[model samples]
Target: MECAAKGLAGEPCAGVAQRRCGSCGAVAYCSKDHQFVHWRFHKEECARLATQMSRIDVLSQFPFTFSVEPLALNHTLPSMRCLFLESIKVHLKGLWKPECICGPEIASVKDLSITAEWNMESSLCPCTEPENPVTRPLASWEDYYQWRSLPLHSPVAVLLHWPLTLYHCLQLSRIQTSRHDGHATLNIHYLGPEKELLQLAVFAELLALFPGVHLRIELVGPAVPRSRDGEVVNISSYAHCSVQNCGCRSSTAPEDLNSSAVTLKLWKGLYHERYSDIAKDSNPHLVLAPNAGVAAYPSWMPTIEMIREIGIPAIFTDFCEEAAHLASCCISYITGQPLGVPIQINPFRQPIAENNSALYIPCYSNCFVFGM
Candidate 1:
C-alpha cells in the first residue's frame, strides 16, 4: 500500500513492503485514514479495474507477462491495429483511413515490383479554351442548347485555398438553380495548367456522347498561366493544381440531382517548377505560371466585363492581400473527394483560409445530405 501511493506521487516505490487495505484488494493505502481519504479517486478506478480483470477470459491463450499496476494496464493491449489499418488504406488507394477497422493483408507500396520508369511530356490542360484565340467565341444560346442537349459530360469545378497543400480544386459542375434535368453551369474563374484539367477535358469529351448532356465549364477568375519569358501562357500550360504540388486546397457545393445538382470539386491546378519565382512576384495573381501552353495574356482573362457577364460582383482587394484572400475564399467550398492530402499539426502545413470562418465543402453521393 505504501509503495503504490509513492508510485502515484512519481517517487520510487520499488522494494517497499506491500500492505493490503481490508475494504478492497483493488487499491492500496498506507494508513487507515489515508485509505478513507483516497477513496474518491480510487472508487471509479477500482470498479473499472475490477471489471477489466473480470473480463479477462483468455489470459492463458497469449504467452505475454502481466503486472497489476494501474498505469501499466493501458500498454497491455495490442497497438498494431492502428498501424495495420493505415497500411491497408495506403494499399487500397484510400485517402482517409476510417477509425478502428481491421487491416487487410497487403504488402506496402515500397515492396511492390515495378516494370519501368519513363520521363514523358506533361499532358496539356483541357479545361480552358486554347491560347491561339484569347477571345472566346461568344456563348450562343442556340449552340448552348445544341451542346446542352448533346450531353453535359465531364464538367468539373475546382476550388482551392492557397499556401497549405500543393494541389487543390477539381469538380464537375451540376445544375445549380434548376430542377428538371441536371442544369449545372461551369463558370471559369481562374485556370492554371495542370494535367488534371486535361484529364477532366478527356472525361468531358467522353461524356459528350450521352443524350441531353451539354458540358458548361467556366473559370471564375482570369485563368491564365505565365509564359517561359515571364508573360502569361495559354491554358494548356496550366498544371492540374488538384493533383500536382501547388500548395492549395479546394471545395465544392452539393450535387443535387432533384434540382440542378451543383457538384463542386476542389483540386490543385498549377505547380510551377520555379517556386522562388512565386515567392518573389509582387503581383499576387501573377505569382505562378500555369503548367499549360505558352501565350500572351489574352484580353479575355479576368476583365471587369467577364465578372459582370457572369453576375459575380467585383471583389476589390488591396493588391496582393486581395489575391491571398481570394485564394482562401475559393477553397472553402470543397466537401469531399477520392483523394486527400496529408493533414499535419504544424502551422506550415495548414491551408490559407481567407476568412477562416467561411464553410465551403464538396459533397459525395454517398455522404448524407447536410440540408433538405
Candidate 2:
C-alpha cells in the first residue's frame, strides 16, 4: 500500500512509499518526520497488530482439531494419544516391572487411557488481571511472575498456566497460556543407560526447536565415562564446562538458529562433527555432545532438574495427582518423589495415565517442568 503519512507541511504522502514500520509492517512512510508525527496513535495499533499477527502465526501451527471429552489428567504429548500413542505402545509398553515404583493398588501400563481429550484448544488466560491487560508473544515466565501480590488462582489454573512440554511444545507444537497461581514440579528420571545420549538428545532437541530459550545446568553426580572404553569425561561431567572442576553450573541457550558455533570437524559433536568419514549436514539447530563419553546423572539428582532448568519448566510428574491412600506419604520435593522411592507416587494412583512408572519413565522423561 502507499504511504499514509500526511502533514500540515504539504499533503498526505501520495508519494511512493520509502519505508514500513519496523515492528508491525502495517503502514508505510514516505518520510521519517511523518512517521514520528503518526507515532502517537500508530504505536498502540502496532502493538495490537503485532499481537494479533503472532496469535495467527501460533495458531496456524497448532489447530485445535483434536479435543476429546473428560480430558486426561496428564498433559503431555507422550501421553497424548496423538503423536506418541504408537511409539509408547511399541517401544515402551512392557510388562510392569514389580519394582518399578510403588503400588498399594495395581499399577498397570494400561492405566493411561488411550481414550482421552489430548489436543489443545484456544482460550483466554485464566489468571487474574491487573488494570493493564496482558499482551502476547507467549510470555510464559513473565505471566507466572506478574501480579505477584495477588491471591493464587484455583488449582486447575496453576496446572494449566504454562503448557510447553517437550511433547507438546517441541514435538507436538501445541501451547496455550494462562495465569499462574501455585507451582508445579517436574520429575525427570534419567533411567536406563544412554543417559548421555538422552541428555544430549534432549538438549539438542531444545536447541533445534527453541534456540531462543535459555538452558541452565547444574552438574551434580560423579562423572562416569561413556563406556568401559577410556577415561573420557561424560558430557554430563562438569568437565565439559569451560570452567575447571566441581560445583559448576552453566547457563547456555541453544546456539541461535541463525548463528554457527564451533565445528567438530564427529570423527564428533552434537551439532558439529569432525567425523569426516561420515556424511554431515550443515550445522544442525540441535546441540550435540561430542562423540566419545556420555554418562548418567546421579540417581539422587535425576535428569528432571536439568530439563526444568532448561527454560520455564512446564510438564510435571504424575500429573500432580494425589492418591486417596498416599496423601500422607507424598513428599514436597516436587520432582514427584525422589529417584529411588518405593512407589512412583501420584501418577500410579491415577486409574489411567499418560506417564510411566517412576522407575522406568519413557514418555515421562521428555515432559519436564520448572516449579515457581
Question: Evaluated with TM-score, which candidate comes out highest?
Answer: 2
lDDT values for all models: 0.24, 0.27
lDDT of 2 by residue, 215-329 (tens): 3221112222223211111111111211222122233423341231111111111111121212232211111111111112123132334332433322223222122112212
Residue 80, candidate 2: Cα error in Å is 12
* TM per candidate: 0.19, 0.22
Model 2 off-target regions past 4 Å?
1-199, 208-316, 323-372
Instruction: Give the RMSD in angstroms, all C-alphas superposed, for model 2.
Output: 26.4
Give the C-alpha miss distance for residue 221 in model 2, angstroms.
6.4
Kindly provide the TM-score of model 2 when superposed on the true structure, using C-alpha atoms.
0.22
lDDT of 1: 0.24
